[model samples]
Target: MKNLILTTAALALGAGMAMADTVRMGTEGAYPPYNFINDAGEIDGFEREVGDELCKRAQLECEWVKNDWDSIIPNLVSGNYDTIIAGMSITAERDEVIDFTQDYYPPTASAYVATSADADVTGGVVAAQTATIQAGHVAESGATLVEFATPEETIAAVRNGEADAVLADRDYLVPLVEESNGELVFVGDPVPLGGGVGMGLRESDAELRGKFDAAITSMKEDGTLNEMLKKWFGEDTATYAPDGSVVTN
Candidate 1:
């Protein structure tokens, strides 16, 4: 009986260790209300929230790492981290590089921006993620837009008037300007670019992609996802918030 008991304990320990699923994620700790570094030196924001949720749903452990925007894709491809969930959008160009899980949130659904001038550089190169909707807008426009290493850089450019305007997910910037002293305003409605944040998995690790997508879909089904959204964007802040819509307390 003693030998049998020892074997059972060993097996249990092994199973426990095996079941301890861990996923490493990367994000830019700059985009406030999304993902940013706090005074406590801890990472927090909307994107982080989504990452946490997916981990819980998938019953996996999650470890977050601070990453520079310019190097995020390269690092993910290099296997530095298990995945990236830093408000990363789904794009054709990126799709060519890596596999992705189903979207956890709408891409530009709640993301919009404003500037000193309503010049409408929606298709111009002003301010946007390199391969995101904002960049697409800049590309469509004839203006020269700038790409920065992170969202904080873009927001700073807008705040200082160094750039014409900063374009990102509207939900992110709306709260920013409202919290600011008074130097920013919306240019138009929330531009629907038809995308959202998703986990970027390695092209070879298709198995993990299925795991993440299943987790994301489960969150969508349960009310946990909705509750999380409300906590971030208020009861009505995130849902149905169109472009140019004023969302302030």
Candidate 2:
């Protein structure tokens, strides 16, 4: 595993070398737009919607499972889930452990700050999950590290100053910061990271890879995917894709 990732932003998930059709997808539904737990207690979000579309296009039964971000990849590797749909960056390092699909959504990396005040938090030591590319970025920043299993816990780490900041995704922090974590903020223009979320299958399921990829491409052509992006990130949706077709909100 080097550092293979989907670059752009607004995505979740690393792929497995193999693929599967009846996918038991994993996500941190707490991260909105990309993946979230709805009021009905059902897993829902951009990636969830995307998964549903893939199931329809590929004619497979798909189930979504919510897991802590820290455990997503491990859980997938353990066979707890079939593929990951959460906004996971497909980095080269991760590619050693898992393979990827053609990027449907891109990857985003950003800094977390206090909502009450603006501070230049970039280029410093920050807190993040272990093994994630964000952790690598934080390591490179030359700041202290506070590793946690969930982004929520990492936010708490910032509030307590255990960490100077949190290096996370832009989409993951918006609703989190807006809902009252007044001392927390998201800083910096998003630093684009690696690959987008894809269907991760056991190394034995290559057949399903073709099906999942086709589903993703079909969603892009039909506009449902972009519409979901707009609903979540608005004009900033441009960061979600490498192509330049986003209609500014």
Candidate 3:
């Protein structure tokens, strides 16, 4: 439960003033394909590309800020950043705390990876990133849920025999499973949850949210969002239509 530590000057200036007119985009720079730190130590991934385009369409000055996944929401609310463009799914619980733009990415699948194809994913110790839908599902699914601060740690738990399986976004796990050769394999049907992935904003920032919402709408209508999805998540990934319908190609 590590928290964001800000300087006295930073806190005194107020979180909103940290960027003045520029919108600070907050993300967990650990989730690959969605977001991760590149070799040059800069944020890189699907969210980075999408966030840049959204800012371009909204005509807003924007910059990226890396934050830990465990504190991402709290940091956004505290004004460490103006918006969250992380791979965060829209959920009712989160919606009550922070408003979200129209979904940029449709609700996708969650899958479990275990050492053996026949592993009892539904009943064994399951590792999942803290504060995620997959973790919540595991907590309520009669399995022992072991929470980790980062996505990589969740997978590591499975690999090190600390957990029987790891549940995470299918798109995130696909590459790992494939690269693991026979060490890891899918064990159960994909579990779908949340509404979709959207930018998180404070309730008071309706104007900012509206701008991103419109940008997302435009991307879906023109298929740029879909193209980016395929480029990062693969051509077979499910995408969102202009009206938010799930369109698999």
Candidate 4:
């Protein structure tokens, strides 16, 4: 299923490769609230709102292209997309390959969710999205890591007993746990990972990166970034104030 999605995205991107003047924003339109395909089959969510504003402020003509998460970075390097505005975290390893704009979202916690409260998240099989920090963490934590191509598959793995638990961003898991009622529950302490979420760009596109960085800085100064974060992640989350201070609950 994941392969099919990637193949379709590749074919669609091949149909009309990016022109010289237009910027193509690449995202994994599968993660909700951060990014997702709405009922209308269009990309919609917090990153969508933030990306649109950044483009407007940077005065760039931009278009959004959905890609599977696993190949998001490679496709960007291949020129299938101009910028990756996905909920990608800024990390040293990733920095070795692509330049990143200043973070639009602050560092958040990764959490464990399981069908049983007694599930040993630390010692048993844990599921995470492939190529994500959570997966990397699980791999090094002495736990058996089972990687899935999508967030939904990780949850499914837990439900089907294929994995003991699923580790993912806390904000993304909260709603799912609530909706699951007594079926699923958060099972361990939240683990902090990554620096923050930033936009990925080609190293040669320093000008483009600077434009987005400036736009993000402007939004931070005006408090618009915090407002959008609150709207999507909720008011209780840690937010950046216009005075450059972080306020947390």
Candidates in order, TM-scores: namely 0.77, 0.78, 0.90, 0.91
The 10-residue segment of model 4 with minimum total lDDT is 1-10
User: Distance (Å) between predicted and true CA of 24, model 1?
Assistant: 1.4
- Model 4's alpha-carbon lDDT is 0.84
- TM-score-best of 1 and 3: 3
Between candidates 1 and 2, which one is better according to TM-score? 2
Task: Tell me the deviation in Å of residue 16 in model 1.
Answer: 23
- List clash counts for every candidate, in order: 21, 37, 0, 0
lDDT of each: 0.63, 0.64, 0.82, 0.84
lDDT of 1: 0.63
| lDDT at position 127, candidate 4 | 98
Worst 10 residues of 1 by lDDT: 1-10
Error of 1 at 44 (Å): 1.7
lDDT of 2 by residue, 20-104 (tens): 4457777778666677778999998778877888888988887778877655666766677777777666555566666567666
Model 2 has an lDDT value of 0.64
Off by over 4 Å in 4: 1-19, 243-245
Q: Stretches of candidate 1 above 4 Å error?
A: 1-21, 109-125, 129-133, 237-249
> Ten-residue segment with the worst summed lDDT in candidate 3?
1-10
| Cα error of candidate 3 at position 103, Å | 0.7
Local lDDT at 103 for model 3: 80
lDDT of 1 at 26: 75
| TM-score for candidate 4 | 0.91
Report the C-alpha displacement of residue 133, candidate 4, in angstroms: 1.7
Per-residue lDDT of candidate 3, residues 1-249 (tens digit)? 111222121122223433258999999999988999999999999999999999999999999999987677778777888898888887766776777898877777888999988777878899998877788788899999999988899999999999999988888899999999789999878887666788888877877788888999899888899999989988888887767678877
